[model samples]
Target: MKAVMVSAFGGPEVLAVVDLPDPHPAAGQVSITTEAIGVGGLDSLIRSGALANHGAAPGRILGSEVAGTVTEVGEGVDTAWAGRRVWALTGESGGYTEQAVVSAETLVPLPADLSAVDAVTLGSSAMVAHFALRHAHFARGESVLVRGAAGGIGVIAVQLAARAGAGAVAVTTSSAERGARLRKLGATHVLDRAGRGAQDAPAGYDVILDIVAGADLPSFFARLEPNGRMVAVGVMAGTPPADFGMEMVAAFRKSMSFATFSADTVPALEQRAATAELFTAASRGELVAVVHEELPLEQAVVAHQKMEAGEVFGRIVLTPSRR
Candidate 1:
């Protein structure tokens, strides 16, 4: 089998495709013949050594999500899963290969109408957006501001919020073109990356889905209305300063709240349900899975480079040669 691995922790150049012996699933696991692999910011962070302390190291495969067909199932797994089309979570690694082994429980049967590219694009990102909005207690008719809303999860969050009857769906994106695209996807207002247009919402936002958390996090937090809730789902700009929370405390009189959410904490059954719902919505044309582009699996390095450079507007999927 051929796989892309982090030969060293550095830039995108460190990702090298190499040949390896084929892997077979163990007990309770299944092996997938990958059709498409999703690439995201976390993969870049791991490749750059930013997550080394978290067990990301040299020689590690650099992918977490994939969409493909099951070729083999291990002990304790159902034979029915073999030859079934599915999208799966490959934990922290092992997805950047022609064949990936993952626990059977992690597989979500792909909708018949969904393409492999769209499956990988919306697979985990839609789940995160769904749960993150729930964490923020988002309600219909409430205003929502999706920070860093041009990325995969952010794009899904925007549409989901709008579809749920949000009174306002505002987004912070890099350019007018990207913002225009978002507007068509249900964003009511488009702000620059610095959140310039947010001032138009005089009462502030009722819910803020922040995918970018860093020095500018406080600025967005301040935009929340009284009794507003802000859910941090990603730290694309890097972690915020330690004292950033003091601002939230200072605004106690507003009764505002801040929280961080990750799909990892969600129960497997709930996650699976959400995944199925998202896929169904997509297949029904109720949700759009934005894919910026698709590259051959061997070009994994180029995929990371585009993602890290902020050149990608949505998800970038890698298609294995077999696909």
Candidate 2:
């Protein structure tokens, strides 16, 4: 087997692709011959030492999501899973490899027609967006805002919000071209992320799906409509200001609510259910999983470079060499 390892915590240059022994599942787990691997921002964070608290050490196998065919099952697991097409969270290892062993609870059977590439790409991003929106308790005819709407989760959030019957769908992005593209994907307004574009939001928004965090977080919080909810699922803009706690005080009179979501701690059954729904939606052509590029697994270092530079508009997937 071959896997990409983080030789050290620094930059994409630290990524090393090397041979490793094939992995087998343990009790309550399954082994997958991976077909598609998801390259995410978190991978870049881990490589750059930005997420040191995540406990990643040198020589770590780096990937969190994968799509593949189940080739084996472990103790107390159903053999029926073998030969099935499935997608899973590799937890902390094996995702960047030719094979991955994941907990049975993390595996979700794919629709017969969904390719492994699409399944992993859409399933991972949509899982987070779905959970965040569900927690916000979004309602029909309300104005919805998706901050950082060009990335994977942000793109999916825009489409899901529109489908949920939002009267207006607004998003913040880095460029006009990206904004134009997002508008075609159901965003009614695309604000220039680095400017005061958000100040133009009319009467504020009802449900805010925030993928960014920084000194500006408080201003984003202040934009919520009365009784509005803002769900923070990412910190792509870096950590929020030290005074973020103080910023929340400004939202008190508006009755605005704030919450944060960490997919890391989401229960297995819940992750399964959310991913299943995304798979169904994708199979029905109701949800779009925007893929920016597909590269061979060997190019993972380049993939991480693009992600960290914000050069990709959607998900980038890595494919293991065909067996």
- Candidate 2 segments exceeding 4 Å error: 198-200
Task: Tell me the TM-score of each prediction against the true structure.
Answer: 0.98, 0.96
What are the per-model C-alpha RMSD values against the true structure?
1.1, 1.5
Model 1 CA deviation exceeding 4 Å by range: none
Model 2: lDDT of residue 303: 95
Candidate 1 residue 109 Cα shift, in angstroms, is 0.8
lDDT of candidate 2?
0.87
Model 1 CA lDDT for position 211: 92
Candidate 1 local lDDT, 84-167, one digit each (tens): 999999985579999999988889999899998899899999999999999999999999999999998999999999999999
lDDT of 2 by residue, 64-171 (tens): 999999999999999999999999999776589899999998899999878888987887789998888888998889888898999989989999989989899999
